[model samples]
Target: MRVFVLDAKKRSLDPCHPARARQLLKSGRAVTYRYYPFTIILKDRLVENSVTHPHRVKIDPGAKVTGLALVRDDISKVVWAAELEHRGEIIHQRMLERASLRRSRRSRKTRYRKPRFDNRRKPEGWLPPSLESRVANIITWVKRLVRWCPVSAISLELVKFDTQKLQNPEISGVEYQQGTLFGYEIREYLLKKWSRRCAYCGREDVPLEVEHIIPKSRGGTDRVSNLTLACHECNQRKGNMTAAEFGYPHIQAQAEQPLKDAAAVNSTRWAIFEQLKRFNLPVEVGTGGITKYNRVRLGLPKTHWIDAACVGESTPKELFVKCSSVLVIKATGHGRRQRCRTDRYGFPAAHAPRRKKYMGFQTGDLVRAVVPKGKCVGVHVGRIAIRCRPSFKLNGFDVHPKYLKILQRSDGYEYEIHSVSSPGLKAGAPDAI
Candidate 1:
């Protein structure tokens, strides 16, 4: 990915090539500013004298992971891309654990407290903590990118699948109910529901055909619940027999179940869309249909960032991907607020340090330590966990704070650059930098 650049006055400028940034640093023209999204500050340049093009920040929001892309629309080029992994599941689990602990403590106490469940009223637009975190994560990154780059517009994939329409097609009115694109929506929903594999044979990497669980001749309608994907062999072998008669009763049951991930995206998509409007930029919204169509039309592989780049109708016919790497950011929130740590049985295991920082070093701060002579005898660079003593944990090695130099403060998120030849091409093959 290209390196973000800022003028001497701390104003955002156009990001420069990695090689150009290197030359600027080596020649004493620019100095390092931030480490995570690797930015630099020029010593001689000013934003007024430099020309910067308008960039669009596109988002492909998901339940667990969201894709972000910084696109130079004027040139139809993608300059930077990132995949943000959310902690909704983690947050949910933590909330459950906290509730369990509270209940246990209350039951063990002598003084009884009355339940006040009905006393609290949720305000309008209220979302569960887990769902709210996803929206916050996307908005945080959008704000960060806007500050780092010249972002003028935003594009978002507002909805992946219309659950209501999928369940009751007639509610969409006659025109859309019989529209050509209706089948496309159903097929996409099925693909995601069945994990893109044959529902009967579990076969993948082959052409999958939509098959009826209960044959239409056998009193089955075209409802989504009766739909299942099958390979040609399975489809032919099963013939007109229902799924239960074909030996897989579970297929029908699973088909009737709603996709939890899809529901999550639907719940928070509008929240993100509305929150983004506060940025005072044109927030373009698109459906999953157009995103997939653009990706297939461009012959690009399926990846979150690529989906983000192909989000809106404004996407160019020809897209130029200018980066060979993508930034993978995972939300690892700051340490918990509880001072006491508990065990699995809700017993106090240990107490946290009263002070978070020691000797000006805190846990999760990126630092570099040079060990003069010891078992860890070389320079170690990584996040550090500080204690009351001078010795601190640096990449699992004990190092004195005197030898440690802070690089970047803790920001509740971990960052890594993954090398990719093309967008979403060989996605599983990521060489970390």
Candidate 2:
């Protein structure tokens, strides 16, 4: 892990090794600052003309999870890695809920107003809230990392313009006759994916409609990956219920679509590229094919951050920390956007916290509570929700402050350091190990 540092005046400096930071802390020369990014504050004066390492930031943007890695110029190792899980789906679901609530309220005993439409025109390069959230999240992390590390160059994966060749090796030239498959061809594809049988009920040679694996009522999209052919009886039986709810255990095997994922990447690829160009650093772009090729060439396992480590011009050949702890920085935007928090009946659900900070801990502050003797005896690490003194709710568990150690201060959003141990590593190894 890269250790961020600050001079005596608190001005940001280039990050150093974790061992150096630990040595500084042990020798009373520096003190720990942030825990998530693992920063340190120096008590000594800033040494003029200190050597700096050339750090490169690699980002593999995805629809749900974005992979980010900071590596030295040589790409021999990843100093820091993160998997940023976006809240795009949650935002879209909340938008649907808001619309439902608004319609319900409007249909009630309320004044009828003419619906406003066409009054506002979408600006150029308009994207849905879900897509916009992902773009903004990538931009947020890029700007934030520049402050902590000496990142001079950026590598971003833009898979929107990839040559989408058919996966079937037999199909080519004349097989590509009428552009792409359709009608009976799509039916055959669905049959091939589902083993030519019903998804929920095993049957053969029956009339089937192009059924949505997840019903439309549940906000499932019209993406072909969500489409499957099911017999008329099975389709009717599976109305509005998920495949799992309809007694299909392994029915979603066909949901993985690189094309659909690439389409999602296309929606915001240029937007993110343009935004990154606005920065002063040099930006380099690559395709998803090269990303996959690099990962396979290096024999790296499939993980968001692992893919990120092998992204772009500097193809990483190896990782020093095989099973490094991943910093999952979920996008929990500043606060609620609604005017007032309300319940389903339109009544005030609850009051917001009066103060941002309670005692010393705030809602998003990362704290570790080690209760020596209680029901919560084990060491629990999570963000603190300080409503009551001495005791506060952590992600969900309740703990007291006496045993709580503040790891990182609240920064509006929540972060988690998942200590994923490498294979064959001893259990006694430290989290950083």
Candidate 3:
């Protein structure tokens, strides 16, 4: 990926190639500004003296993972891309645990208290805490990218799948019955629901056709609940027989199950779309149909970052991916606010430190340590966990604070760059990243 650059006045400049950034640093013309996204500040250049092109940040938001891409519209080149993993499920589980503890404590009857009535009213547009966190994460990154790069526009995949239409297409009349988008929505929903494999044989990476659980000749409807993806061989073998006749009775039951991930994406889609409009950029919204159309037309493989690059009507016909690796960012929130840690029985197991920092070192800060004469004698580099004493934990080893040098402060996110050769890349397509 290219390195983000800023001028001496702290104004956004065009990102430079990694080799150009190296030359700037070697000749004392620039200095490192941030380490996570790898940004630099020039000592002698100003934004007025340098020309910067406008870039658009495209987002493909999912339930558990979101894809982000910074594209130069003039050249149709993708400069930087990242995948952000959400913690909504984790947050929901924690909330449930807290509620259970509160109920248990109330049953003990240690003190007499009046029961409160259900008079609390939620404000308009209020989402649950779990869903709100997903919106906050996307908004936080959009603001950060705007500050670091010259972003003039934003494109977002507003709707992944229409659950209501998929359930009953006749509700919307003729348009829903015979629309190009309805087919795309159903195909995408089925792919996600069946894990993108053949329902009967579990074959992957091959062309999948939508097959009926009960053949139409057997009085089966075309609703989503009756649809299942199958490979050509399995579809042909099934013939006019139902799934049960094909010795896969379980397939029918699984086909009727609704996809939880698709529901989550639908719930938060409009919330994120409304939040992006507050940025005052040219916000462009696209349906899932166009996104898939562009990706297939370009012959790109199926990946979150690649989907982000093909988001809207503004997507170019020829895309030039300029990087070999994509940055994977996971949302690891800041430390908990609770001062007391409790065990399974709801008793206090241990008390947290009153101060989070010790000896100028805090937990979650990336650092490098060179222990001179301890059991851990070699060099170590990772995020540190600070204690009240001088010792700190680095990659599961103890080291003193004197030997540590802070590289980057914690920003509530963990970063990792995965090359195209990594196992996460699907379809075995040639590396365009």
Candidate 4:
């Protein structure tokens, strides 16, 4: 335990004060002792032994210590303590008056262990679907903005781009635009400036060319002001001479397309917000359904579903989503009755298939069967007895239908069901019948 001595009148243990001293009397379990001018706080016993020199002591702010032991060797033991202002009568030098200190010392040891839900089959929490969706929408908007922003303005805009969430892979979902040429490179620039058409001929008849109003070989520098779009044939014919020198009238032009600053182009936050506006969701949700839906819509796959039950009372809540892939949540309500099936749009649904579908198999239909070990195996190609247990008896052998997922007749091993495209005549033609 640690101890500190303080002046009764001046609570501050100033180093220059003669009455201040802080010390460690003992260490282990926890106890205390009094030693004349100063008291020793210890674990088991108090040692009354006196030393030649009082060790200089420093106390943490707000700690209180008392007793004559605070002073030692005819000098003040307190050094480097805050000065306590105001004077009090020193009727007796270093009087050992004291009171009880009741606060307990905190443990310094740390704990390391895995959480309790390590092997839990289901997720602990699920965000409301709406919140998840809105958050997802916001993230997607931001990601798309980064993708379509102008190249020249990208570098500067990236500087002001909110990096607070850039590290979150679920939020950024950004793929940097790629091409070897500089942003100002003519072909791409022209594509941006003129919409990929020849300005002079006003035709998209062929690939366009960047022709100089004043030729570079004739002292014309590479400047947008001296450039115009031309067809390849026209560019070759114009060569290094001004249109005026070639006996053509000069075409005056206004700034039809001004270059976007890299900063303006790169700043994609506004675009992201615009994109997020479409995902109308409640700021709060009932059971995290909204949050989960938004996440699924936005294509964020990694955000863990959170349930409302496990959160702390004081914790602030927020749903998180991404713009990259599906977030599938399996339902545990059914007793594995859920079968794989597709919805109206051909996307996989979370619900399982009905049991009646399994009844579609017929005795004469080509079906794979699994067999138990033995050189002698049952080969029943025709219709056989139908047992109430849902097994078919062929050639005096009984087999369960569940094995159909992995059964192949010739190999004597189990075979999976028919592929979706060719689900056998019975299943394939069910609607027709």
Candidate 5:
């Protein structure tokens, strides 16, 4: 029985109050009929009187007290005792008991209830089962991607407006700071322009927020012309800088796409290659110290590699680096050849086939791992890492490697090969030799 300390006063609990009598009422004590007797504690005194009974005790408002105790299937009998204090000495106390207030719950031998399902309404859609399954899979994939990718990065593409300047700063001297009313105005304008479509992925369902092209603090003006509608994730990834600043290695921006448009633009960059024709590097490559030059010198646009490709949808990794681009086979220091690949948006992609072993999972790769059974159980089950590492590190009870195990192919779907369990490390688990 659950007991509670409701309202406390100077009096000791008494066991003979009407509340105690109510406990007895819950369980049938009278000899005539076996109907369950209802119980009610009319006053605070009755509750205060029943604190010593072995069955239960309580002192509180009637509503809370009522919720605390009830006659149930297994709890057929109840005994209550009251506890109180008075005049420097403990006072009234009472003990109440009741047998079984057996109410007829149900007649087991009765006939079954008639079916009540409606058959008139016909199902609407005509989609095939396989198509529905594919749609579900796509939805799951998109959801996983959203979860895995940083919100800031996604937000940049969705919001396409300047949060720094209200009217043209050159025209109106009003210098609106970042994340201010001007920013909201720019965000609002973009939302109206795009009708809430994701500027990158063309997804219309997800809501978009306003993002700053040039950071507000960096003397960037708050102008609707400069603002864009991007999702929250993309906005965060863009942070407080022009897209031209982030130098990612995996994804590059398209060359034909000019940097003049107000749509959130990310600069694309190609890796420094030994010998290449189609690829363009931002810096001059040589055996001497790496001489980094501005994007203008390399015949490229102003936006950063991160801004042009990583933040926007439909931006392809291959566009950042052409196969014809000279691959810097190796680098001595930051001097001779810094190995560069196309910079990815949120996730780092496998640049070389051989590099896959060194890297773990990416945003979409499905791998079987384990999770702790409960908060403290120490037991675990196989799980999948939906996102990439580095950008997101697995820590504590949720993503710790101590509880992970990758599932292998060919084995039955039910079985999984534990990474730590293996004698030798393979598949990026650990080194076996």
Candidate 6:
């Protein structure tokens, strides 16, 4: 519904309606800038003041993927939507691979000192590589979104499940419950006691619902320790049957404690909130239930981008979505910090790229390329690999330099691509996987 505008020198001024952009283009007062989130640069100065509006960025963060949406307050239409795929698992695997390779080197005749891990200590705000990447990815985009558009405020979904309620949904000890946790209704005691898993199914981090270990239909009382968290499917399947009757007798022998994932999320959530607060913007946090409610109520599929649009306090009643397009981004951190590339046999083959930028563009820069009529026709938008001569790689496809146009530059992280469901807007498409 709205298009972003830049001054003659490409400095962000304010956003205007599509009609104004059209008029400016027709009168030769402006030229098109970016197409994904359409923006234009003015060639003429305007006597009228900048028409600025409060824009909001919402986030729905997950372990694997994160959803983001930018909406103009006046129109409530989505200016941009993205599904950011993370490389946390890849990073973890790479770390493990390095450790294994180092062990093999130690076994061979490679000269080395004793393991020096004892001398190294974790820095402050240290998180496991994967979780740390997740937090940093969210923070990175929060800043990027601000660069392209004037984001007045940010909203995020903080926690998936209330720990206290997960343990004891209804406790009569109001005084005791209200003492610690600063009035947080989540009773993490039960979650911690159960090792954060389903007593019956032993699964975790799947939007767990509170389940009674004993069937209430069979005279079971509402005891805090008797409750457990289970996935929706398991909860419904158990269907009021006691754990014993539900064929989970082995649960008694299994260890009871919060699952690793549950503990990580519980431990890192407040830290993420605190980091966002340092951005100096009015950041709003919401619960997972609130995001789900808004998505279901809006009759939208449960995609990450949709969940992001439904993030916090000022949930839009309607979306001004002109196109159902997604800007899929993958975090490809600032190249690699390592110096050399090695083979699986532990022999050094070559060194990594010494510089981030080549030619005029960086590896993660977004570009549009038009090939000749022989093989690939029409313009294709994707991340580019700046290479030699007239040829370059556009998202793994070979292309020439003359046909490429730079859309956005890499900011030391992430690569963006454009994907659409159908021609002129696809209907009845599946939710983003």
TM-score of each: 0.77, 0.74, 0.77, 0.16, 0.16, 0.65
lDDT of 5 at 253: 29
- The local distance difference test score of each candidate is 0.85, 0.75, 0.85, 0.31, 0.28, 0.71
Q: Relative to the unseen true structure, what is the C-alpha lDDT of residue 73 in candidate 2, on a scale of 0 to 100?
A: 70
Model with the higher TM-score, candidate 1 or 4: 1
- Model 1 gets an lDDT of 0.85
Query: How many residue pairs clash in each candidate at the backbone level?
Result: 0, 0, 1, 44, 89, 9
lDDT of 5 by residue, 1-433 (tens): 1122222332222223334444544564311110111122223443345533222111111100000111111121111211111110000010000001111112233222343568766565433332232223222322322222111111112222342332333433444333334545555657776678754445777868766555554434455444566676766776775645634211112112222222211110111011121222121222101111211222333222212122222222222111111101110111112122323221224443323221444322223344446553444334233333432233223454444434321111121111211111112321110
What TM-score does candidate 6 reach? Answer: 0.65
Tally clashes: model 4.
44
Off by over 4 Å in 1: 110-115, 164-258, 423-433
Clashing pairs in 1: none
Q: Name the Cα RMSD for model 1.
A: 11.2
* 3 versus 6: better lDDT goes to: 3
Better of 2 and 5 by TM-score: 2
Model 6, position 153: C-alpha lDDT score: 90
Tens-digit per-residue lDDT, 81-129, candidate 6: 7888877767777887777678777889674335666778888877888
Greater TM-score among 3 and 5 belongs to: 3
lDDT string, candidate 2, 15-76, tens digits? 77677788999999998877776788888847364556678889999988999988777435
Reference-based lDDT, residue 37, model 3 = 89
- 384-417: candidate 4 lDDT, tens digit per residue: 4343457775545666665333221121111121
Off by over 4 Å in 3: 110-116, 164-258, 422-433
The better candidate by TM-score, 3 or 4, is: 3
Error of 4 at 86 (Å): 84
Q: Which ten residues in a row have the lowest lDDT in candidate 6?
A: 424-433
